[model samples]
Structures are given as C-alpha cells and as structure tokens.
Target: MDVPVLETERLIMRSFRAEDFGPMSAFFADERSFYYGGPLSAGDAWRRLAAYAGHWVLNGYGEWALEEKESGAFVGFCGPWKPGDMPEPEIAWALLPEHYGKGFAFEAARRALRHVYETLNWPTVMSLIEPGNAASIRLAERLGATAERKMEIYGREAVVYRHLPPDLLKEQFA
Candidate 1:
C-alpha cells in the first residue's frame, strides 16, 4: 500500500523520494539530530533513506518525510516501522534541530499515531526512546503512552512507551 500523505497545520508528512536526499542528508549529518540516535555519515544516511523508502514497498507502511508546507522544505521524518529485532511495531520520529521547540515533532507524531491506530488499525503502538532523550519520552507521555519497560536496542538502553488500544486504555485508566 502506498503510504498516504498527511498534512497538519504547518507540516506535510509524505513518502521519501530522491529529491529529499539533500535535506535529509543535512539533517542526519547534524550532531543534534544524532544526540539520541547516534551519528551517521552522509553515505550511511543516504543508504538508510533508500532502505526506508524501499520498506514502503515491502511493508505497506514506512516513515514519512516531514516537510514544512509553506516553505516546502524537508524538516525531518515520522511514521511507523518495525525494527529488525523489535517484537512490536513502533511509531517513531525525528526533527531537524532548527525545527525543535516548534511543536513540529508532536504535531507530526500525533498524525502518525492516529494513522497507526485509526487508519492502519494497529491495536497498539510503541516508541523505543533513548533513556536520555527526555524530550521524546515526555512527548510520548503527553500522547497518553505509558512507560512499559527498559530494554536494549541497537546496543543502547531505551525506555519503551506504549499506547495500547484507546478503548482498552480508557477502560483501564478511567
């Protein structure tokens, strides 16, 4: 299935394309972008983007390149994917440092979560965040995700946040 393009007030979340490589490479090359995810060389970032795009063809869902609607600029990425060893599907996102503190991450993430739950019909979605990435952890909490456990991913310790079925969470939290 083609990943659908989603729009928010200030952003457009759409599939990756070759034209996105330059801005994506710049974002990936930034140390701030790698603060929690780890540094990646330009080549590595390009390869990853290629793989991510291919995943859309293979899995029916993949990361959407987040862009500013007005400026038509690539800002970052957000969507769903299953990591190589992850036991459950995950909703993940990252923003270029310039876009931080502007609520872009949260806005895009909310749209992705809605797609996962309402459109994709996923019963649960989880975020595996680096323990030190307080910003992401807090964002997950604000989305009604609960910290489920601590686990290791890509050799780094991470806190797993889970958003269970909305009805189930309402029944339990209510």
Candidate 2:
C-alpha cells in the first residue's frame, strides 16, 4: 500500500524524504526525542530515515514526517509501525521540543489514529510509553486509550496503553 499524506488543522503528515534529514537529525539530537526513541547520533538519524522509507516498502505502512502547514517546517514524525520486538500494532509520535505543549502531537496523533482505525481497519492499537512520560500518557488517555499492561521493553519498564475499536470499547467498558 502506498503511504498517503495526512493533514490536520495546521500540519501535514507525509512520508520521509532525503530533505527531511537535517530536521530529523535535529529532532533526534534533542534529549527529549531520545526520552522514548532512544539516543541517536546524526548519522543514526540518517540511517533511521532510510529505514523509515524502507518500512513503507516492507510493511505497507510506516511513520509519516510531520510538517508545519504555515511554516512548511518539519516538526517530527507520527504514524503506525510494528517495532521489531513488539507483538502487536502500535501508534507512535514525536515532535521537536519547540513544538511540545502546542497540541501538535495530539493533532497529528489523532489523525494517525483515525487512519489506523478507519482506513487501515485495525481492531486495536497500542502505545508503549515510558512511565515518566507524562505528556504522552495524557495524550493517550485523551484518545480513549486505557492502561493495559506494564512490561519491560528494550530494557526499560514501559506502560502499555490500548485503544480498542469503538464497538469493542462499548461492549467491554460499557
């Protein structure tokens, strides 16, 4: 499946491109980005971008580069992905530190969730967030996700949050 461009009120979520390298590198260089994605050097960021592009070919769906609509600036990335060790589908997002607290992450994430549920027709999606990542936890909660489990991932203790399909949520939580 060809990756499609997604839009939100003030952002565009699109596939990765070579030009995104610089901004992507800058985002990764920030300590906050590593808070969840793990630390990456500039070279690693380029390699990661290449891998992200390949994910589209290998899995048919992958992360989308988040860009600001007004400034046309690359903010970060948000989309669907199945990390190497993850057993189930997951939704992920990260934004430049400057964009934090601006609702960009939530807006981009909401669009990604809609695509996963409505377009991809996924029955359920999960987010594995570090216990100390309060901002991410709040965003997941706002999206109707509930704490499902707490487990170790890549040597870190993480909390798994699940967003059930609308019907299932009603049936199970009603």
Give candidate 1 regions above 4 Å deviation.
168-174
Off by over 4 Å in 2: 167-174
Worst 10 residues of 1 by lDDT: 165-174
Candidate 2 lDDT, 1-174, residue by residue in tens = 567998999999998889999988887787877555656899998888898888888888888999899999988888888856788878988888888888998888888887887778888889888989998999889778899999998888888899767576455434
Report residue 26 deviation for candidate 1 (angstroms): 1.6
lDDT of each: 0.82, 0.84
For every candidate, C-alpha RMSD to the true structure in Å: 2.7, 2.9
